[model samples]
Target: MTVPLLAITAWSGTGKTTLLQQVIPELNALGVRCGLIKHTHHEMEVDTPGKDSYLLRKAGADQVIVASDRRWALMCETPQQPLSLAELAARMDSSVLDLVLVEGFKGEPVPKIVLWRRGVKGGVEDLLDEHVIAVASDEPLQTGLPALDMRQPAQVAAFIARWRAAYR
Candidate 1:
């Protein structure tokens, strides 16, 4: 079965990641195995230089898998073609994940929870689109859509849990 996908989308400094940090634990407590895919615009490196895995990757290896007793990671070089949301989500093992939460990719067609605050770059309406399934804000908002209090991660997690249930 295809795992349910949801996005926590917002502008920079809107606390999207912070909210997820809290909500994920609440989800775990509720027995939802969540897999997360975070999108970043900046250049990022997860491996340290001079390390075997890093050296192998830098030495023209297109893909490298580093495994240990605890966990494993696969690093693939995709400089030529940027990965799409579907591609990234497909990389996740759906058998173990009940839901996949995307941290960004607001422009994508996936359903998302739009976040807003009293003083931010733009209003919640600016982010509204057909893909938006709900709106979470620090202040009260009457947008005809499901409104969630950003301060309470439990409430958000409960909503997500219900959403996941329906997806199944």
Candidate 2:
């Protein structure tokens, strides 16, 4: 079965990563097995330059996977194509994960929780579409969506757990 996916979207500097850092652990404590896929506009290289995996990948390997006893990562070179949120989520082991929390791809069709801060310059309303399920903010606003406290990650995690339960 396809694991449920949710996006936490916000403009740069809106603390999307910070919120997830707290929420993921809370979700884990709630017995929710979580997977995450983050999207970044900058060029990314996960392997070290002098490492064997890096050298092999740079020398023409399209896909390189480095595995250890406890962890593994697959670094695929997709220079011309960018995978959508669904495509990236498909690469995860759905049987082990209850849901996948996304850190970007606000334009994707997946359900999203839009985050905003009081002093942030961007307009949060621009991100509130039918795909947005809720709004997490430092200060409460007039958006009719369910309001979540950005300062309290446990509350956000609880919301996610409830959503995941209903999604299945």
Candidate 3:
């Protein structure tokens, strides 16, 4: 199976995650199985405080696996180094996913669809590069790249589907 990876990127308040909320379902309707990787700067916790797994982690356990009848979650504590996007994707269950949509990692050399909003710190000029396959924006841009309206999820999904086909 050919698993393709694409990225959605924009400034902090530009709704990268919000767009994925709609795009994932749209892609599903189009028969595309999706996985997502999100980048964050804050220190995040996957285990709830005061829980057994949390306690074990706080006591210096490097990794913890919590499993139940319905699901299983693996939390690894690595304060020294973080996993790269490729590293994280390698750990995904490849048998079920057809595409991996990455959010952020704007500087990484990857095929990315950038989102541009008016007065959102950076303009399309900053987003222009060979890896940027398209631009989804609230305002018209002159970057000569294919631009999609931000209000239309179905249209965006279609564009992604076409790209995914070519990518495959």
Q: Which candidate leads the pack in TM-score?
A: 1
Q: Rank the candidates by lDDT, best first.
A: 1, 2, 3
Candidate 3 lDDT score at position 52: 92
Which of candidates 2 and 3 reaches a greater lDDT?
2
Of 2 and 3, the candidate ahead on TM-score is 2
- Worst window of 10 by summed lDDT in candidate 2: 118-127
Instruction: Show model 3 residue runs off by greater than 4 Å.
Output: none
Q: What's the CA RMSD of model 2 in angstroms?
A: 0.8
Model 3's C-alpha root-mean-square deviation from the true structure amounts to 1.3
Q: Candidate 2, residues 72-134: lDDT per residue as tens digits?
A: 999999888887777888899998999999998889999999999866777988888899999
Model 2 pairs in collision: none
lDDT of each: 0.94, 0.93, 0.88
Residue 30, model 1, lDDT: 99
| Ten-residue stretch with the least lDDT total in model 1 | 117-126
Whole-structure CA lDDT of model 2 = 0.93
lDDT of 1 by residue, 1-168 (tens): 999899999988999999999999999999999999999999999999999899889999999999999999989999899989999999999989999999989899998999999787988898989989889998889898999999999999999999899887
